[model samples]
Structure formats: C-alpha cells, structure tokens
Target: MSRIPVLTPETATPAQAEIFAKTVAKFGKNPLLMSTMTNSPAMMNSYLTLFQNLTDGRFDKKLARKIGLAIGEENGCEYCISLLAAIAKLQKLTDEDIELARHGKSTDAKEEALLTFVLLLVRHKGDLTNAEVQAVKDAGWSDEDVSEVFGHLILNFLTNYFWKVARTDIDFPVLRLYDQSKIARGNH
Candidate 1:
C-alpha cells in the first residue's frame, strides 16, 4: 500500500487530472509512480518537466534508461529498480545490459565511464571533487554530458526517495534484486 493515495483520472482534482493527462500523453499511461506523485501536483509537474527535458537531451534513450537503473540500484529503491528495468526492456536493453547497468557498469568503455561517474555522484551525495569531474571528461564525456548526468541524478533521486517514503505497490513485473524487507529497512 502507498503511504500516499494514488490518484486516478476520475478521482483526481482538475490540477491533478491535467497532470495525468500530460503524463498519459508522454508515457501512454499514468504509472503508479506518477499517480502517487499527484499527491502533490507541484511534485508531479516538476518530475514530468525534468523527465521530458532529459529525454530530449543529448544522451540516447538506452543510456538514459541505464542511468535510471544505476541510480535506482544505488538508492536501493525496489519500486524504482523494477520500474526502470521495465523501461529498460522497452528500450531493448538485454538482460546482461540491464544487470550491468544495475551495478553501474557497461560493456562499452565510454558508457561504463559515464555509469561510474553517475554512481560516484550518488555515493558521494553529489560532493564530487574537481578531479572527479575531469576524470569523466578524460573518459570522453563533454561538459554537456556531465550536466545531463546531474539532471538525471536529480530526477532519479527524487523518484527513488519518493518510493522509499511512499512504499507504493509494485505495479510492474517485480525485479527483486535483494530482500524487500531489507531494502525497506535501509539495509541495502
């Protein structure tokens, strides 16, 4: 059960209904995460805006989805991990690819570097050093890519923390990486 009530098209207020409509337009359906986010219209709107913008940014869809998985795993948010895995499948990522991404790795060296950088951001709670920023650049990432990674970090962290707080029901095909009780208890 969700700590926050999941809003539906019929049950939502006009503001929330409009947000749902936008969500459906963008994602083809209102996901449970999006529905739960409607407890605060501002939060839903912020999430949607960043999500839309990031999808349109330089990183390809596959890499973007991989970034989601890496962040979800690092945060130990089962809901987010499952959600991102479903989306990763939709993006045609192989099981190997998905698994590697969950561990913040990639077969491709460039991608692995970026994934490593992303985890560094998560582990350090964004307290990265100047050398850390330059290291990813040395791995062939540009300033724009770094900026987009930060954008994704913020977007993913918001969703991860929300799931941690909400304990929302898993609506996707559950992708359990560890004991759910442990994750919920912050043992990850």
Candidate 2:
C-alpha cells in the first residue's frame, strides 16, 4: 500500500483530470508516480512540464535513463530505480549496462565522466569544487551539458525524495539497490 493515494481519472479534480489527459496523450497512460502526485496539481504540473522539457534537453533518452539510474541508486529509491530500469530495458540497455549505470559507471569515457560527476553532485549535495567541474569539461562535456546534468539531478532529486515520502508502490518491475549476484552469494 502507498502512503499516498494514487488518483485515477474518475477520482481526480478538474485540474488533475486535465493533467491526466495530457499524461495519457504523452505516455498512453498515467503512471503510478504521476497519479500519486495528483495530490498537488501545481506540483504535478510542474513535474510534467519539467519532464517534457528534459526529454527535449541535451541528453538523449538513453543517457538520461543512465543518469536517473545513478541518482536513483545513490538515493536508494527503489521506485525510481525500478522505473528507470524498465525504461532502460526498453531502450535496449543490457543487464550489465544497467548494473554499471546504477554504479555511476559507463563504458564510454565521456559518459563515465558525466556519471561520476553526477554521483559527486549527489554525494556532495551539489557543492562540487572547481576542479571537479573542470574534470568533466576536460572529458569533452561542454558547459551546457554540465548545466543540463544539474537539471537532471534536480528532476531526479524531486522524484527520489517524493518516493521516499510517498512510499509509492513500485508499478514497474522491482529493481533492488544491491547487486543480485552479491545477494545470491550472501554478500549483500
């Protein structure tokens, strides 16, 4: 059970219903996270608007999903991790790729730099040193790319914190925090 009630179209207010329509148009269905967010129409609208904008932002969907995986795992938000993993699988990321992303790693050097920076941002609460920022730039990311990653961080932070508070039921396949291999070996 969720700490927050997941609103349906039938139970939504006029504004929430309108938002649900937009969600349906964009995603074919309103996801459980968005449904639970209907408690505050303004916040939900802001989330949707930010989500729309980020989808058109500098990072491609695959990169964005990787960034989300890193952040979700760092925050230990199973809901966000599960959602990102489902999307990552749809984008054809191998299971190995998904696990690496959750660890803030990538086979691509530039992507690895970005994921490392993202984890730093999360761990330091966005108080990165100048050299830290320059390291990512040196790895071939432009200033604009760095800024966009911050946007991704903010977006993920919102959902992560929300999931922590809402205790929203995982609507996607469950993606636990630790490595399953480790768990099987009694290491986790």
Per-residue lDDT of model 2, residues 1-188, tens digit only: 77789998889999989989888888777888879887898998888889889999999999999999999888878889899899899999989889999999999999999999999999998898999999999999998999899889889989988877777778899988774442232222
CA RMSD per model (angstroms): 2.0, 4.2
The stretch of ten residues in a row with the least summed lDDT in candidate 1 is 179-188
The CA root-mean-square deviation of candidate 1, after full C-alpha superposition on the true structure, stands at 2.0
CA lDDT, every prediction?
0.88, 0.87
Best by lDDT: 1
Give the TM-scores of the predictions, in the order they appear.
Answer: 0.93, 0.92
Clashing pairs in 2: none
Evaluated at residue 62, the lDDT of candidate 2 is: 92
Task: Kindly state the number of residue pairs that clash in model 2.
Answer: 0
